[model samples]
Target: MKDKQAKWCPELGDFAGPKYRAIVAAMQRDIQSGALPPGTRLPTQRDLAWSLQVNLSTVTEAFREATRLRLITGEVGRGTYVLPGNDAVQLYAIDKGGNHDTIDLSTIVPARAFSSEDLRQSFATLLARDNLSDIMDYPTPDLMQRCRSAIGQFYQPRGFHPRQSDMFPCAGAQAALFAALQWIAKPDLPVLVEELTFPGMKIAARQMGLRLVPVAMDEKGILPADLDRAARASGARTLVISPILQNPTGATMDADRRAAIVALAEKLDLLVIEEDVYGGFTKEPPLSLQLAGRSILVGGLSKLVAPGPRFGFVIPMLEGNEARLPEQNFAIDELVHVTSWMAAPIMLELCCHWIESGEINRHMEWQRQEARTRQSLVRRKLGLPPLGRKPAAPHLWIGAGQDSPFAGLSGDQAAAKARAAGVEIVPASTFCAGRMLSDGIRLCATSPRDRADVTEACKRLRKAWS
Candidate 1:
């Protein structure tokens, strides 16, 4: 018998996927069509199960998924109701028109280190070069060699030293990560990652049909015991780690922490993908996991330099072991060829020029000073502690402290509050890989071009919370 009070029953015919997903689709459609308006009490799981002739578990799963999508809310005693603002499907939407009024602390980007004239001059120099036509063509081996040489010089002091044959040019860190995933882990295989990790890694994993197993992390980075447990439980053979200035959360692994992780990885025979894109910000970072034979390092220029150039490197730091290069190189090469053909020659050359001419160094030095200033300003505004290492990280993690306005609120709720105040922030939910919900949001200090904007954003954020 059906429960008389259960009013909304979706027609799941139009959706072609799994039954639960179809139910969600039907619900979304009905909500949008105004057939099921906001505050309309949804059918009880059992009643819906009975009406739709699907299992109770199916309806339960559908409800869970709907809740995750923020389509509906469930009261303690009452049934589920459509969320008031269900029209906005995406939580994080990029406004391309670039609203000046809205202070965006969401994306981590370096502030302007060079003027427009400087950029125009660089392009002019490129155009005037006799080899301009060569750069326009597909990337040649010699071009990659020159880039590798330049990368070696820039990254040598930062604890990265790779043989010329061990390096591959990538369009950006994302591409490098994707290529690394493809090369190391097979599709559908479990890859261990930080519980709260880079959002791009989540996207790339989903795109490539790879399963991500979340490992527990602390203020210092991933816990070795948790990593061991997660790896053993999931039988994951690969791990993607950011040892220095982890994304979303500014968790940098110390020397002892790194050693523990490396030892655990060795024991488990796990292939570690170490991402050190933000490593340059630290004056002296801990030794990279790449120095260990089992690790592959992915480094790039996007964070320290401008995001426009799009140049990154994939190097297998095997410690003088070329035995594994042939197979690994083939896998990476084929993956890159299939996806992007090759890194854009012009972009690579531009970055290489910046590196060789010491312009990139100058840009980094300026970025460091700018980041420290912005960080100090934001911290002061929010009454937060100093974050990261000496040079200062571009981003900082904000948790719901006892006195904070975000207190007693989840990361997403806090972010929503900040967004309401005309400041944008990335919630912890955006970075989560597993079911565990994180408590705080990420604030990128260098996201706003001007220091005053960062200050204003923090002021608004604090006031809104207060």
Candidate 2:
């Protein structure tokens, strides 16, 4: 037993003097002396008890003390391991007196409270379906039909009566967006986007060899006057806008702005691509592509539902505008795999069940209420204005002033600081196109379950700002 203990630290001290403090001091000495390197797994509680000739409970207490010191991190089913040094030591250190668990504010996702047991049951039911073996087979029309039916049912309440022929399921909204861009915009042609927009659209445009033109935006969204000027000045005939919950800014287009933009698109002969990823969350989103005359509406289940669903519906413009799309589009060709599409029926059925049972609406209402409360707390704590409207989406946009402490830091710097403080955030630059610098950052308020987490996260953010 003494030999096994010596493997950790050959020079055994008088650990029997005071069980708790002695064990803690020994572990600290080993760490300082580099006997326990970063990422090194610590001995099991049982083994340590046997080696130290202490009871299992004493070993457990020692291990708990070490964990409190942030000398190690433990994952369930995985043994404890040492943590790396850095400011993360202060932020992640167990003795730091704050939550070390990461608060992911980067991705805009629905709150966990919004998820229902019915959804899980639906997934299980889908997995138990007859001919489940066939789902592993390659893509086929039967799979497409099933997915389309499920998708169509999902959007029926949104007044979109899409047929199986019209619906095309992709990996997610990102894939659908790429396909739409390829089909609509000519290579090297300037495509118009909101001054602040989804970062993925910019990346996709660059990869597709399309130039992105940032149209100016007002309180409502992309200003129609600026859209006209950009369209005429740049001769750009393609426009991509997130009519609902515009990324980074959280500005949704109202009726007047929507009508004006639609009119401009018609006059400019532009192909309008409305990416309404959060359409399901809203009571009534803007007019669908079918109403826009010559537009493409991209809807997905990733936002309102679980992202793992990987199901999206692309409703092309009315019959006559099919020629406007590219002849050989990969989005139109590479249909969703049978297995991926199989997940659709389960999601749709779950959504339907939740909707009928009033659980979905209730859950959404609770999320909206909780989100608003959290957003209000963030506003009060950070001394920032409100970023979300009454519906209260998952994320909020924070404007950091030039003289602000965070102003000197870059986006990555801000993210690193926030992460070091155990709160993750997406910088404003993540949403901008070109080399434009933004004086803001997007904060996602979806994770915190109580006001305490929100307050602590805000306090950490204030420190990061300083």
**Highest lDDT among the candidates is held by which one?**
1
Residue 66 of model 2 has an lDDT of 71
Error of 2 at 245 (Å): 1.1
**lDDT, model 1, position 238:** 80
List the lowest-lDDT window of 10 residues for candidate 2: 1-10
List the candidate 1 regions with Cα displacement exceeding 4 Å. Answer: 1-93, 96-98, 285-291, 318-340, 388-391, 403-405
**Given candidate 2, what's the lDDT at residue 347?**
45
Candidate 2's displacement at residue 320, Å, is 1.0
In the range 357-438, model 2's lDDT, one tens digit per residue, is 5555566566667677877888888877554455566778765656544777755477779988888777654565432324
TM-scores for all candidates? Answer: 0.80, 0.67
Q: What is the lDDT of candidate 1?
A: 0.75
Question: Global lDDT of each model?
Answer: 0.75, 0.64
Which parts of model 2 are misplaced by more than 4 Å? 1-100, 114-120, 289-291, 322-369, 385-389, 402-420, 435-438, 448-452
Candidate 1 lDDT by residue in tens digits, 1-466: 0212337777787789899999999988886786864446677899999999999999999998886665665544445666433212243466824765888888888887889998998888788987778977888777878888998887866665667776777888878887777675465677889978887787776667666677778878999998988888777778899888899788887778878987887788777788888888875543443346766778788888988888887776656433433234354345547333568889988988888888888889888888888888888888877654544789888865576556777666788888888898877757766543345788899988788888888889878776
